[model samples]
Target: MTIAIRMPPDVQSVQIGEQAVVFIDDFLTEPTEMVEAACQSQFSPCPGYEQGKGYPGLRATAPSEYSLRLVELLEPLIKINFQVPEQLDLNKSACEFSLTTVAPDRLGVMQRTPHFDSSSPYHMAVLLYLCGPEHGGTGFYRHKATGFQRITSENLQTYSDVYSDELHRAPPKPRYFDDSDDHFQFLGMMPARFNRLVVYPGSLLHSACINPGIGVCADPRRGRLTVNTFFDS
Candidate 1:
Protein backbone atom coordinates (compact mmCIF):
# COMPACT_ATOMS: atom_id res chain seq x y z
CA MET A 1 0.00 0.00 0.00
CA THR A 2 1.29 3.44 -0.89
CA ILE A 3 0.89 6.01 1.85
CA ALA A 4 0.22 9.54 0.68
CA ILE A 5 2.64 12.02 2.30
CA ARG A 6 2.16 15.72 1.58
CA MET A 7 4.75 18.37 2.39
CA PRO A 8 3.52 21.87 3.12
CA PRO A 9 4.98 25.05 1.64
CA ASP A 10 8.37 26.16 2.88
CA VAL A 11 8.17 27.52 6.40
CA GLN A 12 9.97 30.67 7.61
CA SER A 13 10.08 30.03 11.34
CA VAL A 14 8.08 28.56 14.22
CA GLN A 15 8.49 30.55 17.43
CA ILE A 16 5.97 31.60 20.06
CA GLY A 17 7.50 33.15 23.17
CA GLU A 18 9.39 32.38 26.38
CA GLN A 19 7.11 29.38 26.86
CA ALA A 20 9.97 27.24 25.50
CA VAL A 21 8.26 25.42 22.61
CA VAL A 22 8.28 26.37 18.89
CA PHE A 23 7.44 24.76 15.53
CA ILE A 24 8.48 24.67 11.87
CA ASP A 25 5.90 23.46 9.41
CA ASP A 26 6.83 21.57 6.20
CA PHE A 27 10.35 21.08 7.51
CA LEU A 28 11.29 18.17 5.23
CA THR A 29 12.69 17.95 1.72
CA GLU A 30 11.53 16.10 -1.44
CA PRO A 31 12.98 12.52 -1.61
CA THR A 32 11.37 11.46 1.66
CA GLU A 33 12.32 7.88 0.78
CA MET A 34 15.60 8.23 2.66
CA VAL A 35 13.88 9.33 5.83
CA GLU A 36 11.31 6.57 5.47
CA ALA A 37 14.03 4.01 5.02
CA ALA A 38 15.97 5.25 8.03
CA CYS A 39 12.86 5.29 10.16
CA GLN A 40 12.01 1.71 9.12
CA SER A 41 15.51 0.44 9.80
CA GLN A 42 16.12 -1.49 13.02
CA PHE A 43 17.48 0.40 16.00
CA SER A 44 17.48 -0.05 19.77
CA PRO A 45 14.05 0.08 21.32
CA CYS A 46 13.57 2.42 24.26
CA PRO A 47 12.26 0.44 27.23
CA GLY A 48 9.92 3.25 28.36
CA TYR A 49 9.65 4.93 31.74
CA GLU A 50 8.55 3.71 35.14
CA GLN A 51 5.29 4.46 37.00
CA GLY A 52 6.38 7.88 38.38
CA LYS A 53 8.62 9.30 35.68
CA GLY A 54 8.56 10.82 32.20
CA TYR A 55 7.99 9.19 28.81
CA PRO A 56 10.56 7.02 27.02
CA GLY A 57 12.04 7.94 23.62
CA LEU A 58 14.06 5.93 21.11
CA ARG A 59 17.17 7.36 19.41
CA ALA A 60 18.57 6.58 15.97
CA THR A 61 21.76 7.64 14.22
CA ALA A 62 20.34 9.29 11.11
CA PRO A 63 21.75 8.04 7.82
CA SER A 64 23.85 10.50 5.77
CA GLU A 65 21.33 10.69 2.97
CA TYR A 66 18.61 11.64 5.45
CA SER A 67 20.92 14.01 7.32
CA LEU A 68 22.01 15.80 4.17
CA ARG A 69 18.44 16.28 3.12
CA LEU A 70 17.62 17.67 6.55
CA VAL A 71 20.52 20.13 6.38
CA GLU A 72 19.34 21.40 3.02
CA LEU A 73 15.81 21.79 4.34
CA LEU A 74 17.01 23.63 7.43
CA GLU A 75 19.46 25.92 5.61
CA PRO A 76 16.68 28.30 4.73
CA LEU A 77 15.55 28.57 8.32
CA ILE A 78 19.15 29.03 9.39
CA LYS A 79 19.93 31.57 6.70
CA ILE A 80 17.06 33.82 7.72
CA ASN A 81 18.23 33.54 11.31
CA PHE A 82 14.84 32.15 12.19
CA GLN A 83 16.72 29.33 13.91
CA VAL A 84 20.01 29.78 15.71
CA PRO A 85 22.62 27.07 15.49
CA GLU A 86 24.55 26.10 18.59
CA GLN A 87 27.62 25.20 16.59
CA LEU A 88 30.04 27.35 14.58
CA ASP A 89 31.51 24.46 12.63
CA LEU A 90 29.17 23.86 9.70
CA ASN A 91 31.36 21.01 8.51
CA LYS A 92 30.80 19.02 11.70
CA SER A 93 28.19 16.28 11.75
CA ALA A 94 25.54 18.15 13.67
CA CYS A 95 22.38 16.17 13.12
CA GLU A 96 20.89 12.90 14.43
CA PHE A 97 17.39 11.50 13.93
CA SER A 98 15.09 9.22 15.91
CA LEU A 99 11.61 7.87 15.51
CA THR A 100 8.96 7.69 18.24
CA THR A 101 5.81 5.73 17.46
CA VAL A 102 2.68 6.25 19.52
CA ALA A 103 -0.07 3.69 19.28
CA PRO A 104 -3.57 4.91 18.59
CA ASP A 105 -6.32 5.42 21.21
CA ARG A 106 -4.01 4.87 24.14
CA LEU A 107 -4.90 7.95 26.13
CA GLY A 108 -4.39 6.41 29.55
CA VAL A 109 -0.77 5.62 28.80
CA MET A 110 0.01 9.01 27.27
CA GLN A 111 -1.68 11.56 29.56
CA ARG A 112 -0.10 10.04 32.62
CA THR A 113 3.43 10.33 31.32
CA PRO A 114 4.95 13.77 30.70
CA HIS A 115 8.62 14.23 29.87
CA PHE A 116 11.60 16.19 28.51
CA ASP A 117 14.50 14.86 26.46
CA SER A 118 17.35 13.89 28.81
CA SER A 119 19.92 13.18 26.16
CA SER A 120 23.30 14.87 26.68
CA PRO A 121 23.00 18.09 24.66
CA TYR A 122 21.10 18.90 21.55
CA HIS A 123 20.43 22.44 20.32
CA MET A 124 16.88 21.78 19.26
CA ALA A 125 14.37 18.93 19.40
CA VAL A 126 12.62 18.37 16.09
CA LEU A 127 9.37 16.40 16.01
CA LEU A 128 8.21 15.66 12.47
CA TYR A 129 4.94 13.72 12.47
CA LEU A 130 3.53 11.59 9.63
CA CYS A 131 -0.08 11.17 10.71
CA GLY A 132 -3.15 13.27 10.08
CA PRO A 133 -6.19 14.35 12.15
CA GLU A 134 -7.55 10.79 12.00
CA HIS A 135 -4.87 9.80 14.46
CA GLY A 136 -2.75 11.29 17.29
CA GLY A 137 -1.90 14.95 17.92
CA THR A 138 1.13 16.62 19.54
CA GLY A 139 0.36 18.70 22.63
CA PHE A 140 2.64 21.44 24.01
CA TYR A 141 2.82 22.44 27.65
CA ARG A 142 5.06 24.56 29.84
CA HIS A 143 6.67 24.49 33.28
CA LYS A 144 4.81 26.77 35.58
CA ALA A 145 6.02 28.15 38.90
CA THR A 146 3.83 25.57 40.60
CA GLY A 147 1.93 23.07 38.47
CA PHE A 148 1.86 22.31 34.79
CA GLN A 149 -1.25 22.92 32.74
CA ARG A 150 -2.12 22.30 29.08
CA ILE A 151 -1.03 24.89 26.50
CA THR A 152 -2.00 25.51 22.93
CA SER A 153 -0.14 23.94 20.01
CA GLU A 154 -0.33 27.15 17.99
CA ASN A 155 2.98 27.56 16.15
CA LEU A 156 3.22 23.80 15.95
CA GLN A 157 -0.20 22.77 14.69
CA THR A 158 -0.39 25.04 11.61
CA TYR A 159 -4.12 25.33 12.23
CA SER A 160 -4.22 28.68 14.02
CA ASP A 161 -1.83 31.11 15.72
CA VAL A 162 -3.73 30.93 19.00
CA TYR A 163 -1.88 30.05 22.19
CA SER A 164 -2.74 28.11 25.34
CA ASP A 165 -5.53 29.34 27.60
CA GLU A 166 -3.96 28.36 30.91
CA LEU A 167 -0.78 30.44 30.57
CA HIS A 168 -2.50 33.79 30.94
CA ARG A 169 -4.20 32.96 34.22
CA ALA A 170 -2.74 33.94 37.57
CA PRO A 171 -0.60 31.31 39.21
CA PRO A 172 -2.68 28.98 41.34
CA LYS A 173 -2.05 28.16 44.94
CA PRO A 174 -2.52 25.08 47.16
CA ARG A 175 1.29 24.91 47.37
CA TYR A 176 1.52 21.14 46.95
CA PHE A 177 -0.41 21.12 43.70
CA ASP A 178 1.88 18.82 41.73
CA ASP A 179 4.87 16.48 41.89
CA SER A 180 7.65 18.99 41.46
CA ASP A 181 8.24 22.63 42.35
CA ASP A 182 7.91 23.25 38.60
CA HIS A 183 5.43 21.69 36.17
CA PHE A 184 4.96 21.94 32.42
CA GLN A 185 1.83 23.77 31.33
CA PHE A 186 0.09 23.00 28.10
CA LEU A 187 0.63 25.50 25.28
CA GLY A 188 -0.87 24.18 22.05
CA MET A 189 -2.22 20.91 20.69
CA MET A 190 -1.26 19.88 17.13
CA PRO A 191 -4.07 17.93 15.61
CA ALA A 192 -2.30 15.04 13.88
CA ARG A 193 -1.48 16.12 10.33
CA PHE A 194 0.77 14.25 7.94
CA ASN A 195 4.23 15.74 7.23
CA ARG A 196 3.83 18.27 10.04
CA LEU A 197 6.99 19.16 11.92
CA VAL A 198 7.38 20.76 15.39
CA VAL A 199 10.74 22.11 16.50
CA TYR A 200 11.42 23.47 19.97
CA PRO A 201 14.09 23.97 22.55
CA GLY A 202 15.46 20.67 23.75
CA SER A 203 15.32 21.96 27.33
CA LEU A 204 11.58 22.49 27.25
CA LEU A 205 9.17 20.11 28.95
CA HIS A 206 6.71 18.32 26.65
CA SER A 207 4.88 15.06 26.06
CA ALA A 208 2.82 13.07 23.51
CA CYS A 209 -0.78 11.80 23.42
CA ILE A 210 -2.48 8.98 21.56
CA ASN A 211 -5.42 9.62 19.24
CA PRO A 212 -7.91 8.17 21.73
CA GLY A 213 -10.20 6.97 18.96
CA ILE A 214 -8.18 4.47 16.93
CA GLY A 215 -6.51 1.24 17.97
CA VAL A 216 -3.29 -0.47 16.92
CA CYS A 217 -2.97 -4.11 15.91
CA ALA A 218 0.61 -4.81 16.90
CA ASP A 219 4.18 -3.54 16.70
CA PRO A 220 5.11 -1.47 13.59
CA ARG A 221 1.43 -0.81 13.03
CA ARG A 222 1.37 2.54 14.76
CA GLY A 223 -1.24 5.24 14.57
CA ARG A 224 1.40 8.00 14.56
CA LEU A 225 5.01 8.15 13.48
CA THR A 226 7.03 10.91 15.24
CA VAL A 227 10.44 11.48 13.67
CA ASN A 228 12.86 13.23 16.02
CA THR A 229 16.11 15.05 15.29
CA PHE A 230 18.70 16.45 17.70
CA PHE A 231 21.05 19.00 16.22
CA ASP A 232 24.18 20.51 17.68
CA SER A 233 23.67 23.94 19.13
Candidate 2:
Protein backbone atom coordinates (compact mmCIF):
# COMPACT_ATOMS: atom_id res chain seq x y z
CA MET A 1 0.00 0.00 0.00
CA THR A 2 1.16 3.49 -0.84
CA ILE A 3 0.88 6.35 1.65
CA ALA A 4 0.50 9.95 0.51
CA ILE A 5 2.51 12.50 2.47
CA ARG A 6 2.27 16.27 2.15
CA MET A 7 4.66 18.71 3.77
CA PRO A 8 2.98 21.61 5.51
CA PRO A 9 4.04 25.07 4.46
CA ASP A 10 4.69 27.85 6.95
CA VAL A 11 2.41 26.52 9.64
CA GLN A 12 0.74 29.09 11.91
CA SER A 13 1.54 29.15 15.62
CA VAL A 14 -0.19 30.73 18.59
CA GLN A 15 1.76 31.76 21.67
CA ILE A 16 0.28 31.23 25.12
CA GLY A 17 2.47 32.59 27.89
CA GLU A 18 5.84 30.79 27.87
CA GLN A 19 4.51 28.09 25.57
CA ALA A 20 3.54 27.99 21.91
CA VAL A 21 0.82 25.94 20.25
CA VAL A 22 1.82 25.35 16.67
CA PHE A 23 -0.97 24.27 14.37
CA ILE A 24 -0.31 22.06 11.39
CA ASP A 25 -3.15 21.56 8.97
CA ASP A 26 -3.36 18.47 6.82
CA PHE A 27 -0.91 16.74 9.09
CA LEU A 28 -1.45 13.38 7.47
CA THR A 29 -2.37 12.28 3.99
CA GLU A 30 -5.21 9.77 3.99
CA PRO A 31 -4.60 8.23 7.44
CA THR A 32 -8.14 6.99 8.05
CA GLU A 33 -7.60 3.43 6.86
CA MET A 34 -4.53 2.91 9.00
CA VAL A 35 -6.09 4.53 12.04
CA GLU A 36 -9.26 2.47 11.70
CA ALA A 37 -7.28 -0.73 11.49
CA ALA A 38 -5.29 0.10 14.61
CA CYS A 39 -8.41 0.99 16.53
CA GLN A 40 -10.17 -2.25 15.64
CA SER A 41 -7.16 -4.23 16.86
CA GLN A 42 -6.51 -5.00 20.50
CA PHE A 43 -5.72 -2.09 22.80
CA SER A 44 -4.56 -2.43 26.39
CA PRO A 45 -5.91 -0.26 29.18
CA CYS A 46 -3.72 2.74 29.78
CA PRO A 47 -2.35 2.84 33.31
CA GLY A 48 -2.99 5.84 35.59
CA TYR A 49 -6.00 6.74 33.42
CA GLU A 50 -8.38 3.96 34.42
CA GLN A 51 -9.64 5.67 37.56
CA GLY A 52 -11.12 8.47 35.49
CA LYS A 53 -12.69 5.94 33.12
CA GLY A 54 -10.37 7.34 30.47
CA TYR A 55 -9.78 4.91 27.66
CA PRO A 56 -6.38 3.22 27.97
CA GLY A 57 -5.86 3.17 24.20
CA LEU A 58 -2.81 1.59 22.52
CA ARG A 59 0.82 2.63 22.32
CA ALA A 60 3.57 1.54 20.00
CA THR A 61 7.28 2.12 20.25
CA ALA A 62 7.96 0.68 16.84
CA PRO A 63 6.05 3.11 14.66
CA SER A 64 4.97 2.40 11.15
CA GLU A 65 6.95 3.71 8.19
CA TYR A 66 4.31 6.40 7.67
CA SER A 67 4.71 7.55 11.23
CA LEU A 68 8.47 7.78 10.83
CA ARG A 69 7.97 9.85 7.74
CA LEU A 70 5.65 12.15 9.63
CA VAL A 71 8.32 12.58 12.29
CA GLU A 72 10.72 13.78 9.67
CA LEU A 73 8.15 16.34 8.60
CA LEU A 74 7.69 17.49 12.18
CA GLU A 75 11.41 17.75 13.05
CA PRO A 76 11.93 21.07 11.31
CA LEU A 77 8.93 22.61 13.06
CA ILE A 78 10.09 21.29 16.43
CA LYS A 79 13.57 22.68 15.94
CA ILE A 80 12.18 26.08 15.03
CA ASN A 81 9.42 26.41 17.62
CA PHE A 82 10.85 24.42 20.52
CA GLN A 83 14.52 25.10 19.78
CA VAL A 84 15.15 21.42 20.20
CA PRO A 85 18.69 20.12 20.10
CA GLU A 86 20.02 18.69 16.88
CA GLN A 87 20.07 15.21 18.31
CA LEU A 88 16.50 14.24 19.15
CA ASP A 89 16.03 11.15 21.31
CA LEU A 90 13.47 9.08 19.46
CA ASN A 91 14.06 6.19 21.86
CA LYS A 92 12.06 8.05 24.48
CA SER A 93 9.13 8.67 22.19
CA ALA A 94 6.14 6.55 21.22
CA CYS A 95 2.89 6.98 19.29
CA GLU A 96 -0.38 6.68 21.19
CA PHE A 97 -3.98 6.53 20.01
CA SER A 98 -5.92 7.94 22.94
CA LEU A 99 -9.62 7.17 23.44
CA THR A 100 -11.92 8.70 25.98
CA THR A 101 -12.88 5.71 28.10
CA VAL A 102 -14.34 7.54 31.09
CA ALA A 103 -17.44 9.63 31.30
CA PRO A 104 -17.33 13.23 32.56
CA ASP A 105 -19.20 12.36 35.76
CA ARG A 106 -16.79 9.53 36.51
CA LEU A 107 -13.63 11.62 36.16
CA GLY A 108 -11.37 11.60 39.21
CA VAL A 109 -9.75 14.64 40.81
CA MET A 110 -6.75 14.68 38.49
CA GLN A 111 -8.86 14.00 35.43
CA ARG A 112 -11.39 16.65 36.31
CA THR A 113 -8.70 19.31 36.51
CA PRO A 114 -6.13 20.48 34.02
CA HIS A 115 -2.70 18.86 34.15
CA PHE A 116 0.78 19.16 32.71
CA ASP A 117 2.30 16.35 30.72
CA SER A 118 5.66 16.87 32.40
CA SER A 119 7.49 19.30 34.66
CA SER A 120 10.52 19.48 32.40
CA PRO A 121 10.51 22.49 30.11
CA TYR A 122 12.52 20.59 27.54
CA HIS A 123 9.78 18.05 26.99
CA MET A 124 7.18 18.63 24.27
CA ALA A 125 3.83 17.09 23.38
CA VAL A 126 2.37 16.62 19.92
CA LEU A 127 -1.32 15.87 19.63
CA LEU A 128 -2.66 14.95 16.21
CA TYR A 129 -6.42 15.09 16.02
CA LEU A 130 -7.86 12.19 14.09
CA CYS A 131 -11.50 12.89 14.87
CA GLY A 132 -13.91 15.78 14.38
CA PRO A 133 -14.89 18.70 16.62
CA GLU A 134 -17.45 16.67 18.54
CA HIS A 135 -14.56 14.85 20.19
CA GLY A 136 -13.77 18.15 21.94
CA GLY A 137 -10.63 20.31 21.92
CA THR A 138 -7.84 21.26 24.34
CA GLY A 139 -7.61 24.12 26.80
CA PHE A 140 -4.70 25.84 28.51
CA TYR A 141 -5.01 27.26 31.98
CA ARG A 142 -3.16 29.24 34.66
CA HIS A 143 -3.30 28.59 38.38
CA LYS A 144 -5.04 31.61 39.84
CA ALA A 145 -3.03 31.78 43.03
CA THR A 146 0.36 31.22 41.42
CA GLY A 147 -0.31 32.84 38.03
CA PHE A 148 1.57 29.91 36.56
CA GLN A 149 0.53 28.42 33.24
CA ARG A 150 3.46 26.12 32.88
CA ILE A 151 5.05 24.29 35.81
CA THR A 152 8.79 23.78 35.60
CA SER A 153 11.11 21.52 37.57
CA GLU A 154 12.10 24.40 39.81
CA ASN A 155 8.49 25.14 40.73
CA LEU A 156 6.97 21.66 40.48
CA GLN A 157 7.05 21.11 44.23
CA THR A 158 5.60 24.50 45.00
CA TYR A 159 2.93 24.08 42.37
CA SER A 160 2.03 20.62 43.65
CA ASP A 161 1.68 21.91 47.20
CA VAL A 162 -0.50 24.78 46.15
CA TYR A 163 -2.53 22.58 43.85
CA SER A 164 -3.15 20.02 46.54
CA ASP A 165 -4.24 22.71 48.94
CA GLU A 166 -6.57 24.19 46.38
CA LEU A 167 -8.08 20.79 45.73
CA HIS A 168 -8.58 20.25 49.43
CA ARG A 169 -10.21 23.62 49.79
CA ALA A 170 -12.69 22.98 47.01
CA PRO A 171 -12.99 19.58 45.50
CA PRO A 172 -13.52 19.53 41.75
CA LYS A 173 -17.09 19.02 40.59
CA PRO A 174 -17.81 15.86 38.66
CA ARG A 175 -17.13 17.00 35.08
CA TYR A 176 -14.33 18.01 32.73
CA PHE A 177 -12.81 21.43 33.39
CA ASP A 178 -14.42 23.66 30.76
CA ASP A 179 -13.70 27.16 32.04
CA SER A 180 -11.80 29.04 34.70
CA ASP A 181 -13.11 28.59 38.19
CA ASP A 182 -12.01 30.14 41.48
CA HIS A 183 -8.70 28.31 41.27
CA PHE A 184 -7.66 28.33 37.63
CA GLN A 185 -7.89 30.90 34.86
CA PHE A 186 -8.56 29.64 31.39
CA LEU A 187 -5.75 30.87 29.11
CA GLY A 188 -6.63 29.65 25.67
CA MET A 189 -8.23 26.89 23.66
CA MET A 190 -7.23 24.85 20.63
CA PRO A 191 -10.14 23.48 18.73
CA ALA A 192 -9.87 19.91 17.51
CA ARG A 193 -9.99 19.47 13.75
CA PHE A 194 -9.56 16.46 11.60
CA ASN A 195 -5.91 16.06 10.46
CA ARG A 196 -4.81 18.93 12.66
CA LEU A 197 -1.69 18.56 14.78
CA VAL A 198 -0.94 20.77 17.77
CA VAL A 199 2.55 21.01 19.24
CA TYR A 200 3.16 22.56 22.62
CA PRO A 201 5.33 22.41 25.71
CA GLY A 202 4.63 19.46 27.94
CA SER A 203 4.82 21.64 31.04
CA LEU A 204 1.76 23.69 30.10
CA LEU A 205 -1.34 23.19 32.24
CA HIS A 206 -3.89 21.76 29.86
CA SER A 207 -6.86 19.45 29.65
CA ALA A 208 -8.95 17.66 27.10
CA CYS A 209 -12.33 19.40 26.82
CA ILE A 210 -14.31 16.19 26.66
CA ASN A 211 -17.91 16.28 25.40
CA PRO A 212 -19.67 14.32 28.08
CA GLY A 213 -22.80 13.89 25.97
CA ILE A 214 -20.95 11.73 23.51
CA GLY A 215 -20.35 8.34 24.98
CA VAL A 216 -16.60 7.80 25.12
CA CYS A 217 -16.23 4.94 22.73
CA ALA A 218 -13.39 2.43 22.53
CA ASP A 219 -13.49 2.45 18.76
CA PRO A 220 -10.86 4.78 17.41
CA ARG A 221 -12.73 5.27 14.16
CA ARG A 222 -15.68 6.95 15.91
CA GLY A 223 -14.32 8.08 19.26
CA ARG A 224 -12.10 10.96 20.26
CA LEU A 225 -9.12 9.46 18.54
CA THR A 226 -5.83 11.32 18.67
CA VAL A 227 -2.21 10.54 18.13
CA ASN A 228 -0.56 11.69 21.36
CA THR A 229 3.20 11.77 21.41
CA PHE A 230 5.98 13.13 23.61
CA PHE A 231 9.47 14.17 22.60
CA ASP A 232 12.65 14.84 24.55
CA SER A 233 15.52 16.67 22.93
Task: Please list the residue runs of candidate 1 whose C-alpha ends up more than 4 Å from where it truly belongs after superposition.
Answer: 1-9, 12-40, 47-63, 75-87, 90-113, 118-122, 146-184, 212-222
* Residue 100 miss distance in model 1 (angstroms): 5.4
What TM-scores do the predictions have? 0.56, 0.89
Per-residue error at 39 for model 1, in Å?
A: 7.7
Each prediction's whole-model lDDT (CA): 0.45, 0.75
lDDT by residue (tens digit), candidate 2, 28-142: 6776755765656566667766565333333433236656765777777777778776676532377766777676666777778888888876788888888888877999999
Across 69-115, the per-residue lDDT of candidate 1 in tens digits comes to 66655544442443454444233243333334333222223334344
Clashing pairs in 2: 46-56, 53-102, 55-101
Give the local distance difference test score of model 1: 0.45
Candidate 2 Cα misplacement greater than 4 A, ranges:
1-4, 8-10, 53-63, 87-92
